[model samples]
Target: MKIRSDILRIYQSLHTWVGISAGLLLFIGFFAGALTMFKQPLDHWVSPPAPVPAMLREQEINSLAQQALAQHPAARKGFIMHLGEHENTVATMSWTAGKPGRELDFSGKQWMANLDQEGKLQAKEELPSILAQMIDMLHRTGGIPGKIGDEYLGGYLMGVAGILYFLALVSGLILLLPTLAKDFFALRPGKNRKRFWLDAHNIIGITSLPYHIVISITVIVFAFHDQFYDSLAEVVYKNQAMFGAPPPAAAKPYAAKDMLPLTSIISKVKAEAGDSRISEIQFFGLESPRPMARVALVNPRYLVQGPEAGYLIVHPYTGVIINASMLPGKESTWSAIVGPFFSLHFGSYGGDMMRWVYFAFGLSGAFLFYSGNLLWLEKRRKVQRPNQPLPVQTLSTRLMAAGTVGVCLGTVAGVCFTLVAGKLFAAAAENINFVYLFVYYSVFLSALAWSYLLGAARASVDLLWLCVLAALAIPCSSVIMALQSPSSNNLTGPGIELVAIAMALTFIYAARKTGKRIRDETKDSVWSLQQIQ
Candidate 1:
C-alpha cells in the first residue's frame, strides 16, 4: 500500500508536467481537427459552383480525352478522369506532372475541357481554396512541414504527443481514483478558483476518457501506418502475396478518341456496387499498349471503410471487365484492417451528422487543454505581502498564461482572416498560400508579444475582444456576399455565420468574466489586475 501511494504521488507530478508539455500542440491539433470534420462542407462553401452550362457527359469525355491526349501525349503515361467529387478538378483529365502522389503532393498538371457558355471547348486548370486545405494541413502536420516533400513531420510530433497524452490520461485517472466517489462530479465555484478550474477539468476529462483514448490511439496508428505496413509485409505476411500484378501497359496502340463510353462502365459498376457513388475513373498504361481504367466509388451507408477503392478494372477499349472488386463484395484482410483505421480517424464513414458531433467533441477537447493550462497557472500563482513591489510572476508561469491567450484567441483570429480571404477572392489570387501563412502567423505571434508585454490580466480581456472581432469576419463576409448577389444558394455561409456569432458571444462573455475576475480578485496573481507595476 505504501509503495502504491508513492507511485501514485509520482504519477500525479508526472501527469501535471506531461499535460502541460503536450497541451498547447494538442490544442492546435484538436481545434483544427474539429474544423476538419466539416472539411467537405466548408470546402464546398469556399469552392465556386460548377461553371460552364453543359455537364461533362460520356460523349463529351471523348472530346476531352482527345483534346487532353493530343495536347499532352503523356496523358497515356498516367491519367485519371476527375468526375465531380475530386476537389478543384471536376470534369477534368489529369496527367502526371511528376510521379503523382509519390513525387508530387497533389494532383499535378490537370487539364479539363469544358464547353463555354458560347459552346466552345475551353481547357483550364483549377486551384483549391486555401482555407479548408490550411485547416487540414494544420491538423495533420501541426503546420510542421516534412522533407522529401512527401513525409508528414507534424504527424510524427503529434504521434509522440499522443503517446504522452495517453500516459497523462492514465496518470490523471489514478490520481483521481481515491476521490472518485466523493468528488466525481464536483464543481466547487467559491473563493478557491483553483478548485473550480480543477473540478471543471476533471469532470470534462473523466467524462470524455474513452473518447480521448480512441483519438490518441487512432492518431498514433495513423502517424506510423507506413512503418506498420512495412512490418506486416516483412513478418506476418512475408510468405503471402497480398496483391496481384500491376495491370500491364496496353498490348496494342489505341486512339484516345476511340475510348469506350463512361455511362455503361458506371452503370455496370453501379449494378455490381449496390449503392456506392461512383467518384473517379483512373486511366492506366495509355503509354504502354493495353489501356485499362479503374472505376472508384463512395459507399454512403453501412460501410465504415470509405477509403476502399470500391473499384473495378476494365478495358476501356473493349468495355470488358478485367478484374472485379465490386461493392458489397468481399475484401482482403489487409484492406479490411487498414480501411477502418483511416475511416475512423477521418470520420469519412458517417455523413454530416457524425462530422458535426465530432466537431463538438473536438472543440471540447481544445477547451480541456486550455483549462488545464489555466489550472496549472492558478495552482502556482504568487501573491504579494505588505507594501513591497508585487512578486514577479515566474517566467514559465507568465509564458504559459501568455501562450493560452495567444494561441487560443490568435487561432480564432487567424482562421477568420483566412476565411475572409477565401470568400472575397473571386479570381484565384497569386501567392494565396503565402497570404494564408502571413495572416495566421502575424496574428499568432502578435498575440504572444502582446500577452507578455501587457501581462496576463490585461492581455486576456483585450485578446478575447480581438478574437470576437476576428470571428465576426466570417459572418460579415458572408453577409456582404449575400447582399451583393441575393440569388446565390449560400448553403454553408449561413450555418457558418450562426456558429461564428455564437463563438463571438462566447468571447464576449469570457472577456466580461475575465475582466470581473481581474477587478474583483485581491491576490497578486496572474489574473489579478491589482497593483503589480
Candidate 2:
C-alpha cells in the first residue's frame, strides 16, 4: 500500500511537470493549425486575387507552351501544371532544368502567369494573387524564411509534447472517470473560481476527446513525416525501387530550335487524355531563346480517381504524346496522401463548414492545456507545506506560463495587425508580415513578465481584455478601410471583420464573469462589516 501511494505521488508530479512544460506550445500550434484550414477563404478575405476556374482551351495553352518553350530551354526535363479548383481556377507553370542531378527542385524555372481567354500570357501587373500564398507561408513557418529548421524543431518539440499531451489527457480523464457519472456536461456557476475552472476544463476536455485524439495522431504523423513515409515504403512497396522514373538530362536538345504551335499539342493531349482539364503547361528548357518545349496536362480525373490518373504530356514541336503515367505508381500516390495531412490538421481540405469544426477542436485543445496548468497550480495550493510552499515554480514553468499567455493573446493581436498592414501597406505588406511576427514574439515576452509580476488570476483577467482589444481592432480597421474607399476589394478587410466579431463576443463573456466576481467579493465585505457592527 505504501509503495502504491509513492508511485501515485511520483506519477502525479511527473504529469504536472510535463504538462507545464508542453502546455503553451501545444496551444499555439493547435490554434494556428485550426486557422490554417480556412487558408483560401482567409486569402479571399485579405485579397481576392481574381481566381480562374479549372477549364482551359487547347489553342490558348498551345500559345503559352510555345511562348514558354521559345523563352526557356530547361522546361523539357520535367514539367507540372496545377489547374486551380472550380471556384478558384488558376494556372501554375513549372519545368525542370535541362540537366538533372544539378538542382534539388525537379521543377526547374517557375513563374505564376495569368492566361487570357486565348491562353496568352498576361503581364505581371495583371496577376497579383500572391497574398493567399503569403498567408499560407506565414501559417507554415510563422512567416519566417530560410529558418524552416527552427519551425520544424518547434514541431518536433510539440510532437514530444503531443505524446505528453495524450498521456496527460488520458490521466486527466482517468481522474475524472469517477466524477463523470455525477456531473457530465455540468457547469454550476456561483461556485468558487477553482470549481468553475475545473468544471469548464472537464466538460470541454471530455467532450472533445475524440477530436483531440485524432489531431494528436495526425500531428504526430506530420512531425515525423519520414517515419510515415518509411512505413509506407516498407509495407506497400515491399522496400523496392521508387515509383516514378527520373526525367532524363538533355533528352532532346534541338540544334536549330523552331517555334512549335501550342494549339496542335493541346488538341493531341486532349484527344489522348480524355476530358482531363489542363492545370499548367511547362515549356521544357524554354529559358533559352531556342529550346525544345513539352506541355503537361494535369488530369482532373486523377484528382478524384484515387491516385491512378496520370498527366498527359505533349511535344509542342511535333504535337506528339511524349510521356504518360498513372497516378497510383508508388511515389505519386504516396506524395498525394502524405500531402493532405497538414491540410487535414489545418482543416483546409473541406470547405468553410469543416473549418469551423476544426477551429472548435483546436481552441478546445488550447483550453485543455491552459486548464491543465491551472489544475496543477490548484493541486499544489492544497498540498504545499509551510516549509516548502511550492518553491517559486521551476524556471521552466515560469517561462511557459508567461509564454503561453503571451503567445495566445499575441497571436490574436498579430493577425489583426497583419490584416491592417495588408490593407494600408498594400504593395509593401510583405514587410508587414515580418513586423507582425516580431510584435507577436514581443507580446509573448510581455505576457511572461506580466504573469511573473502579477498573480496568475489578475494576469489572466488583464490579458483576456487585451486579446479582446486586438481581436476587436481587426474588424474595426477593416471596416474603416472599406468605408473610406468602397472600391477596395481586399478580402482581408472582411476576414478581419469576422475575427473582430469573435473577439467582441469573447470579451463580453469575460467582462461579465469578472464583473460578477468583483461584485460578489464586495458583498462579502459588506456582510462581514454588518456582523462586526
Candidate 3:
C-alpha cells in the first residue's frame, strides 16, 4: 500500500486546494439540502389554515372543481387536485394563474376551492408560503443568488464547485490510501488538535465517500443538464430532437366537465401503477385540445422520477395512459438508467427511514466541509516557541477562517431567522416569500460582514448566540399560534417545533464551546481574540 512521496505530496496539495475552493459552498448546499428532507412539514408549519375546507368527498371535489371552472376561466388552464394525503395540502383543489414564465416562478395568483357546509363551492385566492422553496433553492444553488440569463447564477458556480469537489474526493482518497490499513478507523482525540480534526474528517469522508460521489456527480449534471443536452443535440444528434417529436394536438378543445371523474382517473392510474399510492392529480391544459393529467404516486419500494413521487400522465378525457416512463416497473430504458440517480440524490426510496438517513448524511456532509476548512486553517497557523516572540498568522489563513465562519454560520443563522420571520409575517405580509428572501439575505450578509469586522473568534460566538435565538423563536412562534387558534395547529407543526428546539439547544452548546476556545486557545492563531487585536 506504499506510495511515492512525490505522488502523495501532489495529491495532498490537490485535495487541499480543491476542497478549500468548494468547501463553503458545499457546506451551505448540504445543510440546506438536509432541511429540505422535511420540506413538507416545514411548509405545513408555516402555512396558515386552509382558506377552503380541507376535507372533501369525491363528489364534493367534482362539484367544487366544476363550479370553479364555470365561474373562473383561469381554472380551465391547469390545477392541482389534492387528495388530502400530504401535510402541505392547503385545499381540496388549487390552481395558479401565474405569469407565463418558468414553472418555478412565484409571480402568480393562486386559487383554491372546496365545498362549504351548505354544499356550495367556496373558492378564494391565497398566498402560499415559500419557506420550503427557499431552502430547496439554497440546496440547489449553494446560496449564490441571482440569475444568469434564464438560469440561476448559483447553478453555474456550483457546477464548477462540483467539479472541484469530485477532484478533491479523488485526491483525498489517493492521499488516504497509504495509511488506510493502519488508520482507517483510528481517532486520536487529545492535545494534538490538528490530528484530532484530521482523524474525524478522514473518518467521515471515507465512510461517506459513496454518498459524496453521487452528490458531486449529480450536482454537476443537474446544474448544467441544459448545456449538456444542447451539446448532445449538436454533436451526437446532428441538431435533431433528442427524444423525437411530441404528439400532435387533438382536433378540438374540451370542457372541464367533459373530463373523466376523479375516482375513475385514480382507479385507472392505480390499475396501471399497481400498489403505488396516489398523492395528487395535476391537470395541465385542461381547456386545451391536448389535455393531460399527471397522477403523482408515492411508493417507497421503488425509484421515483421526482423528489417525493413518481408520476404517470394520462389523457384527462379518455383516461388512456399517455406517458408511463416515470412510473415504477414501467420505465423506458433511458428513464430506467436515469431514474436511480434522481432517486438516490432525492432519497425517494425506502420511505421515512431513508429520508432520516439522508438527513443525517446531509448534516454529516456539511460537517465534513466545515472541518476540512478548519484543518486548512490549522495547517497554516503559526505557533510561537517558548523563547521566541508570538508568531503572526498568515493573512490567507486569517481570511479563510473568517470566510468559513461567516459563510457557514451565516447560512445556519439565516435559515433559522427566515423560518421565524415566515411565521411572524404570515398573517400581515402581502408577500411573505419576499419577506423570507429579505430576512435571509439581511441576516446572512450581516453575519458575513460581522465575521470580517470582528474576526472569526468573536463572530463565531456572537452568531452562534444569534442562531440559538433564531432557532428558539421557531417553537415559540408555533406555541403562540397554537394558543391563539387551538384548532389551527396540526401534528407536523409540533414535529417542526420540536426539531427547532433541539437545534436551539445544539447551538447553545456550540456557542459555549466557541467562547471557551476563544478565551483559552493559543493567542498565535486566528481563532483567538488576541489575533484580532
Candidate 4:
C-alpha cells in the first residue's frame, strides 16, 4: 500500500505497453476459444441430416465390420465404430482415407458404412464439414495463418503473446496493489469517463486472474510443445527416446475376424475405465502386425486425455488394455502430474457445467483485452477546448483505435457469417471446407478495410450492426432450413441459434452505446466523428 511513486510509474508503463502488444491477438483467441467449448454441438448443428441405416443386431456388427474390411483395404489402416446415435454420425461405422495429414486437417475422404434392410453393407464416400475445426484453428492460432515447417506460424506468435500476457498480468497486478484494497469494489460511474473504464477493466481482470494465469501458461506450452520436446531430447535424454520406443510388431498380420466382438470390447473398456460411457471405439493397424483399439469414454469425475473424452488403448484380439495412462483413475505418475494443465486449460474435468463457466470466462477475457486497447486509446486522447481548433490525435492512437475495432469486431462477424454459410452451402458446395475459409477471410478482411476507411468512431457503429446482422443470420438460416426439411433440425441447432440471438442483441446494444459515445462523450478524442472530418 506504500510503494514509491517511481516504482508505480515503471509498472504502469510496463503494463500499458505489454497489454497493448498482446491484447488484440488474445481477443481473437479467447472469443474463438469460447466457441470451442461446445464443439460437439457445433459439429452436429452444422451437419446436414442423412438417412439413418437399419439398426444392426448385436451379432450383425461384427459381420458388417468383416464385410467392410474385406471389401475396402483402406479400412485396415483405421476405422471408428459408432456405439451411439448422434446428429453428426452419418453411419454406424466410418473411416477416412487418402493423403495423410494432421488430425485437424480436412483433406482426407471419409467413407461411411452401415447395414441395409437385408443386413448387407451400404458404404458411401463424402467430404467432412470443417466448421468446428476452423473455429478451433482460430482459437489456436489467434487468426494468424500460415505455417513454419510442421508448426503454425500463428502458434509461435501466440506463444510470444502469451509470454507478454503473463508479464502484463504481473505488472498490472503491481499497479493495482497500492489501492487494490480500498478500490477493489469501487465502480464509480460519472462524468469522469476514464475512471469508469479503468474501474470496470480492473474488476474483470482481477476477478478472472486465476483463469487468465492458467490460460497464459498453457498457451505457451501448447504452442511451443514441439520445441520443448526437442530441447528435452537434446539436453536431458541425449541418445535415449523420451517416452521409450513403440511396442514390437506381431509375427504376422491379423484379420478383422480375429478381433473380438464390439460388445465385448465395450464391456472390457467399461471394466477397465470404471463407470464411464463409451462414445467411440477406433481400431488401427488391424491388418498390420500391431493391431490396436482406442476407446473414447466420458466420465465427469475424471480428467480427460483428449479435448472431450478420456482414452484407453487396447489390443484388439486379446481385449487387453495396452495403455491406460490416459484413462481416469488409471494414469501413470507422469500423466497424473501433467493432467491438470490440460484439464484446467480445456475445462475437461467437470462436464457441461464447467464448459459453460469456461465459456463465460473466455468472453470476459476477450472483453478485458478489448477494453485494454480502448483504455490505451483514451489515455492518449488530445482534448479540445471550446472555440479552439480540434485537437490533432496522434497517428498511433488513430491506428490503434481502427485496428482494435476492426480486428475484434471483424472476428466476431466473420465467425457468425461462416456459421450461416456452413448451413446454407452444406448440400450445394463441392468443397465446403474451402467455402468456409473463403467466406471467413473475405468478411474479416473486408471489415478491417471498412474500419480503416471509416475511422474507428464511425466504423464501430457500422461493424457492430454488421455483427448483429451476421449473428441474426444464424438462427434465421436454421429456421429456413427447418421449414424446408422438418427432420433435418436437431436440438443442437436450436441451442446454437439461441446463443446467436443473444449475441445479436448484445451487439445491438453495443452499437447504440458506441453511437452515443461518439455523439456526446468523445468529442475531444480519437473516437469523435469530428476527428474524421
Predictions: Cα RMSD each: 4.3, 7.4, 2.7, 2.8
Question: What lDDT tens digits, residue by residue, belong to model 2 across residues 284-365?
Answer: 4432333333333333223322111334445444555544543222124555665344344545333456657877787677
Candidate 3 lDDT trough over 10 residues, lowest sum: 99-108
User: Candidate 3 residues 139-202, lDDT tens each?
Assistant: 8888776888888899888889999999999999999998999999999988898899999999
TM-score of every candidate: 0.84, 0.70, 0.93, 0.93
Give candidate 2's root-mean-square deviation (CA, Å).
7.4
Model 3 clash pairs? none
Give me the displacement of residue 241 in model 2, in angstroms. Answer: 2.8
Per-residue C-alpha lDDT of model 4 across residues 1-533, encoded as one tens digit per residue: 78999999999999999999999999999999999998878877777766555566767888788889889988988899987555567788999886446436655669999888788888999888878888998998987878899888998999999999999999999999989999997999988877888999999999999999999999999989998999989999899766544467889888876778777887788788778777788888888898889898777797766786778888888887778877877778767877778888899978779999999999999999999998888777644233556555767778889999999999999999998998878788888888888989999999999999989998999999999999999988888778888875433446788889999999999899889988875455878887732
- Tens-place lDDT digits, model 1, residues 5-63: 88887998899888998888898899999988866567666655554234467767666
Off by over 4 Å in 4: 51-58, 103-107, 237-245, 251-257, 382-391, 490-493, 521-523
What value of lDDT does candidate 3 attain over all alpha carbons? 0.85
Which ten residues in a row are the worst by lDDT in model 1?
101-110
TM-score of 1: 0.84
Off by over 4 Å in 3: 50-55, 100-107, 235-245, 251-257, 382-391, 490-494
lDDT at residue 203 of model 1 (Cα atoms)? 90
Q: Per-residue error at 384 for model 3, in Å? A: 13
